[model samples]
Target: MTELGKRIVNILQKKSSWESDKERLLKEIQQMEDLDILQDVWTRYERVQKNPDISGTRNDPNSLLAYYLDITKEKPEEEFKNEKRRTYGRDGWPDIDMDFCDDRRHEIVNFLVGKYGRSRVASIGTVQTLKSKAELRRVIKALDPEKSINYTAKKPDQSGNFALQNEILGTLPKILKKRDGTLLKNLQEVYNEFNEFAAYMRKYPQVFETAKRMEGNISSSGIHPGGIILSPVDLSTLCPLHTTRGTNEDGQAGASKAMVTQFTMQDVESLGLIKIDVLGVSTLTTIDFATKLVKNNYGIDIDLSDLPLDDPLVLELYNSGKTDGIFQCEEAGMKQALQQIQINSFDDLMLAVAMYRPGPKDYIPQIAKRKQNPNLVQYAHPIVEKHTKSTYGIIVYQESAMHIFVELAGLTPTEGYTFIKGAAKKKPELFMSMKARFIKGASKISNKQVAESVWRQMEPFQGYAFCAGHSYAYAYLSWKTAYLKAHYPVEFICARLTEKSRRRKTDIVYKYEQDAIKNFGITIHPADLNRSKLTYIKIGEKDLLRPLLIKDVGDKAAEEIIRCQPFDPDDLLYSFGMKVGGAVNTKIVEVLASAKMFGNIPKPKVLSIFEAIKAGRQKSKGRQTGNLKKGIKGTVKRRKKTLDLDF
Candidate 1:
């Protein structure tokens, strides 16, 4: 067996408490001559050890043997299917699965705290600084010293009696501008204008000097949303720590506090401390909830990791531009790009992901055209062909740039990486020096003319590029979400609604509801007192909108109302006021009644019933207090409630 295989087998043996049969299986694996077969067996063994319940062979000896033999029976390509690449950087966090729910992300931080001790793990801090606009506004305010300042200038006209009057401050770059003029392009231009007002401002150079000093200066410190630093020793030993107050989803400060580093992420890295980003991704939470709903409603236990890459329904959805909720593809621009590209494969999806950025977005039409007519595609040179063939003779990734430098110019991997980085930064000196070295090296292999032509073709990509590996990881997630939405539309929509509702993103929730109903033929049932849950739920064939979505009905009210089921108007008012202890109130009843939540009763009738209940309760309380004052203490039987009030 290979060294990796041996280590895996040893670990599995220790984990599974090896028996005689396992030992024999390990010996069989070790004796195998074919490395491919050995690797397959080791992978299956590892999977079995990690999750025995999902494995075909949990504890049965014959089943385990059959499973190993079955995987090896196929050809090498079929036996070892290449999974989509998940890229990781210098940090330890896995980039692919970092999009966890907020609570789960916090739970992970808490887990690290429990493992490493609280004093060793803390969140990283960030410095907020002034930007160009703010700096300009401040400088202008300081220089003018007026809330609203208007300055006018006159230009000699053909008829000198009526000269053209131009408002300088009122018609400045932001406030207004001449349609044909590019004079006031930016604040710097305003400060350098040749006009008299600008010359007047030049007298007060201190204002500009003060603004320049304040610009880019640290304004305040805040916690990095996802970056967490863990040290081997107490974090205080490395950097200063301060307690920062945290806000809830509504932006209100809460009692929760977090220990944050005085140094930012870059400073922490310079100190050699480990910083990992624990990002919160609502899509992962959506997927989790969708899977549960699918299993609960359809009895299909989906394993998102093992989904097929080429599902016709999913491909159809992508081709049709129905990717409203797919990860990274939900943006309107990305959706339009998908429709234009007419994706037929996962590779097309990866290309779309990489090419949808600001700089690369200009190349989308060319890419789509080439994809439509493969005959139009051509490579610059033979070496270029090798690296650019995957992207149809176009540079779509940074890796492609590196490969081109390494293959055509004969640059070392380190040198190639440096060349790409320098090109990306637009460092003219570094780029020219590297260009000379590349041409010289290429002359040794081919002609310098061919190398120059290739370099010209790669120039545009230097501005912006995506790593193909990261794009593939994103494409993998996009494909999974697309697959789930295409197959289980109802469950996916319900999960999506629940997710957006929890985040209080009413617009997104409403959009999903409209799309589900209009596009997918899914019915949305209104929040019913007896039926709706606290969150959107999938009934037999329809989705029940959450009661919390109703205006004036808070989450606590919805939960209590859902808990106390089968309520008439009387019970609802009693529960709101007395039974559930004011968890639901008059406002909630009025909103629910307006939403047609109280059976067949109208809002007017529901209000009247609520008023009657209030009056009866008041009278009963007064009588009880009066009787107690007269020393006539006896139990009074309360009236049984019913929903029989006239409009």
Candidate 2:
């Protein structure tokens, strides 16, 4: 065994609380070694271990060694009676996806570059190809830049060209979508299936034929968002390297100082390089911030990763359809599904995540009806019942299909995985051949009629089936967030506000601030000089001081105000002018006054004092400015009728 294999054995021997079967752990370690993935698993484990505070990492769900090593956080307990299923890449590379706080994900990436020499670590590149709609427009421009083609005229005339152009443009086919509303990448499939589109293409071969040739040509190259490749040798020696422009926070490409591979993710992986997906999930940041708030306000330290899966109040929040900040449960469709299904257990929540997708979506009503009345639940065969009993005897997961393929069809795990992938990729020949093999193999176990029936049950959902690993991981995060929101509403909202504020989404911040006030019943005080800091802070039992959300009042102004705490409303402008000049500008003061940061002092009076000071400065350009101070004092003293008007 290699050092990586020995380390895996050591971890399984010592850290086996999650999977305590010593013999089973050893077998899994040996299987990983035999599969030539042990070194890759160890490499990923080392990279992730450097960032101890990462949310979690998810490896191949079948890699029990990964779960034992804590590289994959979710346990692989059987959801239903389905046996375990493992899907490998064509080249047998294992996927190790790491999730981190969205705010701090750059730190880990930088650390990886430092550890592995900079030349060895680069972001995966992607080639942006022209799609059907873009190709149609491009072809139209290239053929007739000056005028449109007139199909109806004898001389190919230009008089009624615009109308004819509109007619031809209207025939451009809309992109095809999966049953789940996800846009499919294949325009050829769209052309083949839609009769009107195919007829129009044949009718207008000049434009359509040119478009077909130029449809998939590369337009631009850019870096992948999350995929980072770690090559053993210098990357430049193996493939070309390019410096890509940075993407802004708003997702626009701009000037950047980062290196990327010239090849795409598939090409890089094919070159025998390891790619680690360091996905930045903002919800993880939300959970982290909320937990820290809980610790600060209530002195209750929350270990979010170790949270119990079964919480009645969290489940009740999901049931109530008030999951505003909870992950995966906030969407209106998901909330409606929650209401209909009434998730009674963690298992149900996981199933809901899995089932609430495109192809499996059709089974939700059946599952709900079955859940409401258990007698309606029936399976085509015992194998089906055994695999799908947890999901109300319906195939709701891709793993369930794999179980049927292996157990019923008697295909090996590798063959079953290939069949599932073939179906997913829409490889008609591969899928049809596998389907034939499945029916033949299954007939020996059960009758031919029964085998076909069970296969039919699996066929419809195979393409759209959600991965159980993904559902479990997401459901775990969703429940953790729901638990925090149900118990600690103030902390969660404060965290959400701070995060949104950091992102410069003031509209969303204010929206959630109002939500916190109306729904959480928490009073949000406007940004105050005496109380407010850089972020939302819990002041009283039910009160939270809103951060400096006023426009033009940036970090410098907020920080200066914090430094000079407890400002008198009467002398705020004077104090800022004397102590924090330029930092607290006249516009910032005006906005603050408008935001009611000055307590009972009226907005007009504050602006007039600054106006009076400006007038006094003009009058005494070179002489004594003593009269300006007195004039500001006079303006500050006018606080009488402003109180009694009750405006």
Candidate 3:
């Protein structure tokens, strides 16, 4: 480890936490400068990366501030008297050849609106929403009354308008001038408004809970993931809240909430402030699927918490390729390999799980053959045996790489760990290139050919593979789930595949039929609205585990139906709030049908729901159109045509 890294570790050990954090991480070289080692490290790193720029130029104030200004800048020709670039200041400071007081005002207003609500947010922004000549006149008077309000210009009684445009663009009318400039104190106003809004929101527990539930779990809509809202007290106290003038750790440009709602999620984050980002994750969805099914099967009776850590059935399945229901072993190739080895223990299970992939699967058959006949299993060396005994002298996982690094390369725990994480998953070519360099840097290696051979062996385990610890943890979860599935087949499968929506409706159906119902000869009765449960269900006397597999029903619709009626399929549609005004849409019908709402309804009537859905949607569209027309007419009549002022 570098001296700085060691120092950081030492500091972390003492404090049991970080103080400066993002600042310290990005500007560690600043600390090193005190020791005179900064120049050497920075220079060397820059040379290695072949980067012309300094390592931390993002920390440069002038550069950071200039970047902020650039976001608000526009074409000079668009704003000025004409297109012109007048040079004035030296490298660090540049002069604005043209006044963008108009653009500045607009940006300020936008920022205010975002930080505060539209009603609360205010900056001397462009008076674009002026209601009348009086409102315009009031704004113009605020700027420079003498320069604006030309009562006797080309046309008489020019009450209010922009001053600059009045002389050049147009006559000043009763309105704020487009060139109305914003003062620095406007920023203070915006900041105050934003702070107030943050405080106001804090009063509402609902919003806070919503923000909390969504804290780390961002969805399709919300604030930016890494963006944080920093309050003054929080900023000065907890952390430095160091920023490049207007932004935070988040990818926020200088845009504020009022300025643009779009940037609530962008580059702005502080320590105590909230960070919300909506992310799409297949893993979360997958977990949702598993959880839903489990609920449906046992009427909330299944205990996922009761699953044991070391179930012999799961281990046996892992070894014997009977892992169809396990998370990792549902696939074809994995199943085939497992059946061959028929693993005998947890170590064997972990090995099977680890070696079941491409880079490792090739060695599986040989390993399996050897396990079946131990005489054929060759120990390449005592060192190799020491490293690979768990898997019979074969390197397969990220730990294998870490192991080689520790045993052969004499690297420290931290260094070995870093190499394992960084290089294990990398491609062979990358691993080879890095290994060559590492070997070349070694002084003990004399024969280049022998060194190259040793390096090649190191390449396989270096890229992005997991540390055995993580993989084993995952394997344990997998085994737990598999054990539940293997031993308590009906209860476990039902729990796993209960609500169609718990997992994908289709997937729940597939598992209920293919894996659970079929595997155990459990009956899958058609969904009957009168008797069907919204989740994976058990029917009277027969104890048949039926899935909500109604042809038209989706999981959500099914859940709603179940909630409204408690799985009584025999309930009348009208009784369940299916009003005559075409309330039967595709989603509603799908839910009802999936839950088997209609026991005797023919295909003819069932199909009619499609037309009903379309007709209902059309009626809704018509109402929307009429309302929109009314709004347009009302707005048009409200607008007075007596004034004409160029904005």
- Winning candidate number (TM-score): 2
Ranking by TM-score: 2, 1, 3
| Residues 227-297, model 3: lDDT tens digits | 22323342223332222234332223333432223223222231223222112222223334445544664
Look at candidate 2 and tell me the lDDT of residue 218: 100
> So what's the TM-score on candidate 3?
0.46
Q: For candidate 2, what is the TM-score?
A: 0.82
Q: Write the per-residue lDDT of candidate 1 for residues 485-519, one digit (tens) a residue.
A: 99998888888888888777878888888888888
Each model's TM-score?
A: 0.74, 0.82, 0.46
lDDT score, residue 199, model 3? Answer: 51
Off by over 4 Å in 3: 1-310, 319-322, 413-422, 425-430, 433-456, 462-464, 503-508, 540-560, 563-583, 586-597, 605-647
| Candidate 3 accuracy as lDDT | 0.43
Per-prediction CA RMSD (Å): 10.1, 6.2, 25.5
Residue 607 deviation, candidate 3, in Å?
Answer: 7.7
* lDDT score for candidate 1 against the true structure: 0.64
TM-score of 1: 0.74
| Ten residues in sequence with the least summed lDDT for candidate 3 | 75-84
Candidate 2 at residue 473, lDDT?
78
